[model samples]
Target: MRKTLPLIIFITLTGTMYALGQSAKAIIPLGGNAWVTGKATITDDGLTNWENPQDAISIYFRVDKAAELTFALRVRVPEGKSKISVTIGKHTFSKQVANTGFDTLSIGKVMLQPGYIKVDLKGISRSGNVYADVTDLIVEGVQSANELTYVRTGSSFHFGRRGPSVHLRYNIPQEIKKDVKWFYNEITVPQKMDVIGSYFMADGFSGGYFGMQVNSDTERRVLFSVWSPFNTDDPKSIPDSLRIKLLTKGDKVHGGEFGDEGSGGQSYLLYPWQAGKTYAFLLEAAPDKLYNSTTYTAWFKETGTDKWLLIASFSRPQTFGYLTDLYSFVENFEPDNGDKIRMAYYTNQWLGDSAGKWHAVTGAKYTGDETARKNYRKDYSGGLKDGRLYLRNGGFFDDLTPLNQKLEYRTSLPPPMIDFNQLPR
Candidate 1:
């Protein structure tokens, strides 16, 4: 079932926010949904970083019906008159404003079908220090019999702009339900889909994630991390007994602590992994019920390579269980690159039992985070493609995969043949 956020339309005025249900006019804060190019940026008060006419901004929203939608903008000229334009598809609306104070400027209307819509806002002509500082997009015409989806105000705009993170929850067969000791998966990101800031997570369990990332133009990484048994997000606050103790790391890999999204022991190798090449990830969990602890180790390598370079190993003090809640995911860790679309194909998933037998994964469930569930930035989809489970997000695409949609690859992929004893310690 698609878990959609309630029909809570937000209206921001005088630095305050209020929610209304299917109102005549709903405010879509640019701070939450705008993707800026050039020198333009998003601020707490909205689009205040715009200072150049050459800069461009894109605002995305999804409408669920074919309707004539009216548009308006809340903006400030600061000094003199400025002319700005809002373009949607083939329709463009331009208006002139000279309001020193923030005021609403109507930007005409358009007939739109049911899908994701992009509103391109740019400066046309201005006689001020900067172009219009736009704050919000006020939309009407969808009230009683229509549905609309956009990132709402009064929340963290960073996550809103970074868009939704989707996951593939792999279904481990019931026969291997108890002592699944290892998880193995492969990821192949398509060419041109390797947008910066994308983390194509290949292996994710209840306690940690292992993946490859397009860190920046000059950097790529094979990253791995495991959470501490403590519940705090601050790594420094975790008690030594409950903290994730680093066992070892590979040569040239940086090992340290990470925080803010569940503090954990972090390690990464600065490898220039490229798109279009399949990379392999293997994660192992060894639980000791007597000591109430579990040790997790991660390894990554190219598919054709004979070596599995160990990423890192961590021992969580308060947990004692085999790997459960297995999954893989695709997410944008950096909000600045959220406008660009990225995707990856996860294939040949297998689980290794305690008896050293490999089980082929046949089923998975596609899901999204709070962003997609709340209907904020709906450009996310996932399903089985060519014997592989693929996940996609961003780019403002119209296609949507159903939330919790079950995806299965019926063909039997070749299971991995590994000498477990020869793995790096």
Candidate 2:
């Protein structure tokens, strides 16, 4: 018993640490301090054992149920036993690793429970250098897989090597209505995404944006606003005849005198939105009869509801005419402060004109801000998966070279068919 006293103590400590870690939530990279023993040192790039004979890194995670788990990792082990040992509770999986360069490894089918599960990656008993470098760790095949897939998260500050904070957009290919009157789209918000960006926008930022967002953990709101061609912080500075007017703001909508991105305009907020539910937005734009202004009206109807409630209506006296560009984007606004992943689903996009006919928007491409393209080593990723366009940018990486998969011009549908008479005003 005396001879095995040290072994028992080590086991007890490891189990205790892992239990504590499992109780909380964290994203543990190799360089983070979630280890239990073995004196493992992790550089900015990876975890390696240069002096110690025994080394290990331990992390804990929680799951809602007993299901299959996948471990996605970039690893390299050269001239050692050529293997790494992974421990979950009492089960162990010995996986063969590459000898050089990083390779993505998938180790899965590990049974997990509805509570805390500790994973231990330990060095094998061998003669050569025992080392492994990990980059990405993803847990899939869960009860909330749909919600999890939409989590938008990445490194935010890339030491001035950051990607453009832009949107994943789809234009109507060609202008359908010379004088447009209506635009429509259906959107669904994921249940647990901490932040929901302006997922839907008309005419991009130059024109304006209408979106549903979780501004903060507790604040859920629908945001709608348009940009003013004039540059001024004071809303009153613009002449009353030239400034935009909020014709009507729906119940619970509250906003006035907002400014950002070198443009000053108006905004409205509506609250108590439901997650995991579909919501439809119908936008109407027409020139005001009395003034040389254009009125934009937003109508919203939640799924399972009968009547469309008018959200807000604003008229821009200086700007007039149709929706020039339309698209959607996903982003992590507080990437540096929060670990909450967010995702928005955009579908059933449609457009209309004065003729009272609606056309579907069929094609879109993957593109990022010019800043990211200029430093396009590994800061942005935009592409299509399962007919859906996605944009993922910014993440912490020691060597961001592997994030260099930039795909463009991913069209989802055939050319859009536009046939509508210009409805008379």
lDDT of candidate 2 over 1-425, digit per residue (tens): 45532222111221111112112112234332233355665443446663354665654344545666656555666665466677776678888775567676766657665544556776655445555656434454443322111111232222122223445455553557455577776666656543433233322423567767666557766677766556676555766666667777777777575653544455556566777887776677877657667777776667667666656777777676777666666544432222223445566666776776666666565555544443322334445555654444443221222223433333344322332232111
TM, every model:
0.93, 0.53
Best by lDDT: 1
Off by over 4 Å in 2: 1-164, 173-177, 196-206, 233-237, 338-340, 376-380, 390-425
Quantify all predictions' global Cα lDDT against the true fold. 0.86, 0.52
Which regions of candidate 1 fall more than 4 Å away from where they truly are?
Answer: 1-23
Clashes of each: 0, 7
**Per-residue alpha-carbon lDDT of candidate 1 for residues 60-120, written as tens digits (9 for 90 to 100):** 8888889898888898889988888889879988888899999998888899999988899
lDDT of 2: 0.52
